[model samples]
Target chain A: MARFKNKNKKAPVRPVKNQPSVDHITGQKIPKSFVFSRGKLPGPLRDLELDLRKLMLPHTALKLKEKKRNKLKDFLNVAGPMGVTHFLMISNPKSIPHLRVARTPQGPTITFEIHEYALAADIARSQARPSCPKELFSNSPLIVLSGFGSGGQHLKLTTIMFQNIFPAIDINTVKLSSCRRIVLLNYNNETKLIDFRHYFIRLQPIGVSQRIRKFVQKHEVPDLRNLQDVSDFVTKVNRASTKSAVRLQEIGPRMTLRLVKIEEGLCSGAVIFSEFGKEADDAHEEEDHED
Target chain B: MAAELQTLEAAAAPASRKRKPKHKKSKNPSKRAKQKASPMAAAKPRQPSKKMKKLFRKRAREYHSDEEDDGDVEREEEPSSGDEEDFDVRDDGSGGSEGDDEEDGRGAQHGITRFVGGCRAFRVAFMKIMKKHLPDDPLGPILSAHKKLVAEKLAEDDAEHKKKGETKKEKQLAAENGHIKPANFLDAKEKFLIGVATKGVVKLFNAVSKAQNAQIGLNPSKSKDTKGVESKIVTCFFSFIHFVVLAKRRKQAFFSELQKKNTQVSNSRNDEKGNVTGWAPLCDSYMLTSSKLKDWDKMAEPAAVVGQEHESSESSDE
Candidate 1:
């Protein structure tokens, strides 16, 4: 009777041991604990946050909802970039879910969690290198994430990471990187010096994607000027991004979702608005029927 | 007795008529002899010059063997492979003049010969002999007919040259300018010459014998496109497709002729084709590469050979 009672009782939540640490929701591995805790924001980070707030404060009044504004502020505090006007945060954990932000001081910035995905596991899975060494760590060198907007914007974010030296080392004794020796910390803290100065920090220009997205969004009924732009719209559909757009439609309360059904390579189904809730469901049912 | 005397007189009458003509010819026999002698004197044969005699002797010695080889039962079965190459050289008579003309201008006159053993005339003669001896050979007869036409054309050209009294200098000049027509001259009117232009300068070549005279035809012109500035030059080579088309047509004609003849002839022809097709492309590519070499810069100074000592020293340093 005691065993049955104990079985009915739920187990207490505890962190798993020895496994590489990663965020459950974002799948992004938490980096070395350098970001100061809430009540203990250090001088440099405080100064950086203050500078960002000062830089962003004069641009425009914060017109976002109170909840969204608080979230954005918290994110900005962590990632100290200036002039962040809008952002789309991905919540799923299949790949590293990230915030696709525009109107940043450094142009477009994709802030995401750094995951401890392995390059060796990827190479092994691909069977690319026949004689791959057993000692090779399973941490990936590249982290690619993407999301879409109903505003016809395709955001592709690619970040490269490795077991390299953390650049923001806050120590006078470890000023000269070559002079210092690497002391391995347990299982997960092994690192070597890699210069990620030029490539990693800089943003690769989105060019056509950003421009076309802005153009289409600005003119809701897109009257594309050229054949190239028209072709781009027709052919270039980011499948990964469609989920975010669908999510966006589901979330926005006031905005009307104009769902167009595509069937048999033609728009044969009805044009349903979000106001008529059953019609949207009907259109989806028709799509499922076609499938 | 009167009837028999009339019959005898009738027979004697025709005999008497024949005797009367002989009596008349005997009176003017010297006049008839003088008439025949005078005609003979009018067409006096000129004695051949020492050089001409020597050339004839040399030709007899060299080309005579080729003629004898045609009749030779053993040689007829398996022809000398080298002679077919010579036949190709000789068929294009312009090839001879081209070498001479080039040698005159360039002065590197080492390997220039006007006559090879298996010329068109010689081949025709050889074919004639082969046809007479080897009657069963269907190819021999047909090829001989074509060669005979070629020989006739050559003979006509020789006659025309004699009539015009074209001097050696004029002939040489004509050859140098590529004005001389090929030996297998189709018509008196049509002349086909290929011109290769590089950077603004043009070099001409006889279409037929250009491959055979690669040394002359391939060498880049000494004349400059401009006086000072070096121009970016482009050169176009003669398309081997024309030769391929011609060969296809010839093959079709030969096959058609073989169909008319026995299957044995067709089998032998196919065997001959198999032998030729294997090496023909290799020979053509060699000819093309050799002819396409227009780097005349090497003529000024012989390219210095890097010696073993220098190579060893360079390798040791490395």
Candidate 2:
């Protein structure tokens, strides 16, 4: 019996801790809704951080994509009459896999570990955020590069972009009395639209206004006078806004961003994506929601 | 088609001149702030009748005369310079004299009577003044002709009003007021309609768009089958699909069906004697008809709803 007890003690003691468990891959809250969310390490990429490994999986990537789509649909669904605030979105461009670029009040910033993927982070830092769709934008951070470490930690970074420029858009809720656009969101949020470089390609204020008016007319609505009365309501953006537009400064452990605008009524935005540890606020949120 | 033609003719006539319903309100000589019960504050202080002015001044020499002493009755004074100023903002600017004289002439000749509903005593006072001011004689025949011309001109003015109304409709559709801007065929079908309220897609709610959008489900079952039948039955007033089928015989059948709907108008055939047209009652109804068959057709109900909207649009265009 003493020999058996000695054998039990002799076996290598596995490390144990009293801290709360976390989703190792996302560094996000894994709620009771999750059936099996624990991360699996890959043979070759295992040495990379767990967050880096998470990006490599087809399933997780798909899940993240679905997560965004559902959020978009949910937002469009709920944001109709009642209002929404702090609504978050994660957009995936066809070009990048690991990048979780988000449009926010701050300029566009990237999130990634510095040491683990030194070469990839360095290259990303060198590239400038593109600026054609926008006369100004933010990109390429060095701190995001600095944060990358080979240790198996899950890190997330959110980059904020898209400044709402509909002047006084937040001051009042608009009711489209004539048209049947059942999915109209608050004007402030509409300016938060994504990938709109395609929508304005052949756009004209008069023509677009006419088409929308024609829809009202077809509905047998008697008149569309108020909108017509203000012919100068020509642009979606308030080029005259006074607020600052966001610009990207640095990326690494955290993103440093600033906003500047040329006109008085508009705002520029920034986005920073940083990976938080699993036992952080998000986990607390998950716990709070669980009960 | 004939009913539509009459609406067109009515719309095409020049501005008609209707005798303006001269419900002329007499002026007030007293200049007082408007009280709800007030007519025009009494007019221009009455130039003070010679004897009244003498006594009023004599009373005032004691140093004060309350406004009540003006002896200004709340009478419906004849339309005067002051009354011109009181006319509504769409002022004809002819001043009170012209508007009143025209009113007096027309009212006296046509035996026009305007009934005032508010303030019984005030209205009674107004009638006394109306009878007193009524023109002593009708204006000469030339005046009558001129007045008739004006009334006809006013009626025709409706056509002009509608012409401006068409352009106004486009603006109004942009604006959203209540005048039923004339409609056209393109407006009969809208591109986007509310689909299922839960589904954000118009394809679910908008029958028209649903029928048109191909990437969605195959055309609704009924719409697919009915594509070959040639008629304008428009069966699916509430269906979630819209398909236009083109078969000619069906249109002829539809006309026959419509003919059956208006039996009296369709049945009447009057036989007129050589020169004297006798009042032979059609269908011998108590709502005796002396009007021609064409006029009876003009009053047809289906034609009124189905064609009036189109008639207004076509007439406005012409």
Candidate 3:
């Protein structure tokens, strides 16, 4: 009778517990992220958000539910308990896709205006054969930041923010097997644009004949119809290198981002830098006048 | 000094005619006496009066406003020359350059020198509103909590590593005794399943490519290869059907095996439930009561109709 009566009652709400996972070797708190869209996103932008979530794998909420009524404060409240270190929000307010990467709670948010983007599926369709294994997204991709070092103060901050968004790997203790993907951010000084590329890391052995390698890896029996002997397959002429090489094959949701604004707080606060704002130049002029 | 005074008098001559001659003559002696008392004021460059300073500031503000409107350059220059004539009438000496230097300094202080437009103006206004609402140091608590979490995690990791270090000596001793940890290997069933899945995928891909080639060969432009293409297509179609049937059979076999195992477990439960049959009687009684309730409405309607007919016959007899 009690069980039946209790069935109509609401379940008790559970309080969120703050328990951050730590790295075993480095003793650093593993950075986790939340990738969600704030406003209405186009279908392609939604897919881009999913790709970004996949890029921050193993520690991100890949299936986070967000409603129109939910505000940034709600995410911040939840982020505190979940130990979310960063938030990547995509919002397309007036047909312009803006991506905001902010450190959780109190932040130096970097907003990027996406000039162009290509989804992973589009990249795959253009390729002859796209290799995407199930384990490709099991670990977070390694971030390779380039051309950001020689820029201004805001660019330096952007470089640091991107570097810390993913988990930091101590080279001496890091395992090579865990690195299956790489996210490269290449900045072009001339155009003032950042080229974002996600690539799959492939390792191929050197000095291996193509026919024998295919047989070994794919278990495919090569045709020996024109060969004098089976030994001919093994002794096929191939370029031999002393060391095995690592190859990077782009498996991408590629993006070209122009840094539009940098705010002192999460999506708010004083504008530290802006590409389109006259205050940016005005501020520089003010500094010069002061000097 | 006498030559500079003559030049000053020449610049102020037009102003004396505009004003009364007697008033200009009365004020000139007092100005000369003040300049004579402070010879350094005369030696130094002439400074614009407060009125002239205000006019220069206004001209600068107008220039910025015109720039904001993207006004004509000639229009802006025309206003500047008229203001300079007003400056000549108001001061005894030419102070146009000094007024400009002072206005530049004041403009920088007031943030009015630069032409702020578009998003920069919005940003400035946004920061002002944000400052009004947000606390001066709102990040303190959030930052402290983050730091504390990192410190706690580091402490926990240190303890874990200490424990691991304690176990390392025993592991080394065991290794010395030739009882090292065994290498991890995949289970045979898992390995075989992986191999089977990979080979199956490769075969399907090859079959698909062969079909595509056959399709290309069957194009109307390649009429000479039609016969060979037809045969290849037929073989590929048959192989595809074969693979589908094999997959279907495998799925059926797996589900049937699961069903068999489930029924065996249920039958064992039935064999043990001979003494506990309370549920059967309870279910039978519940079904009987439900059926009786379902028939109650029909049974009551006939009774009410018979009563109504009797009542009608009684009234007719009366």
The CA-based lDDT of model 2 is what? 0.27
Q: Compared with the true structure, what per-residue lDDT tens digits does model 2 show for residues A1-291?
A: 454556546766669432222334434331111011112212222222232222212111212222312433343344332222222221111111122222222323232211112212332344364122221111110101111222222221221122211111110121111112121111112222111100001111122344332332243222334565322432322232211111222111111111111111111122122234435524423422221
In the range A173-233, model 3's lDDT, one tens digit per residue, is 5555577777878787899988777777764545667764565446564677899985576
C-alpha DockQ of every model: 0.01, 0.02, 0.02
Per-residue lDDT for B1-318 in model 2, tens only? 334334433322211122122212334422212311232342212232466445434533332235443222222233332333433322333233234433322322222221111122332444455466445534322223257776667668878999899987765443221112112221321111111111222222233333443334665543321232211112221121221133355785686557546655433333232013433332464235444444643544444333345555665566
Candidate 3 lands at a TM-score of 0.43
**TM-score-superior candidate, 1 or 2:** 2
Docking class of 1: incorrect
DockQ of candidate 3 (2 decimals): 0.02
Candidate 1's residue-wise lDDT over A1-291, tens digit each? Answer: 354457766777667334333434445443321111122222332332232222222222222222422443464553433322333232212222111222222323222221211121222243322232212112211111111111221111111111211222222211111211111111111221111100011111122254434433342334455657545653464222211110000000000011122122111233221223666547444433332
* Cα deviation of A63, candidate 1, in Å: 32
The global C-alpha lDDT for each of the candidates, from Candidate 1 onward, is 0.29, 0.27, 0.61
TM-score of each: 0.12, 0.16, 0.43
Query: Residue A263 of model 1: what lDDT?
Result: 20
Candidate 2 chain A weakest lDDT stretch, 10 residues = A194-203
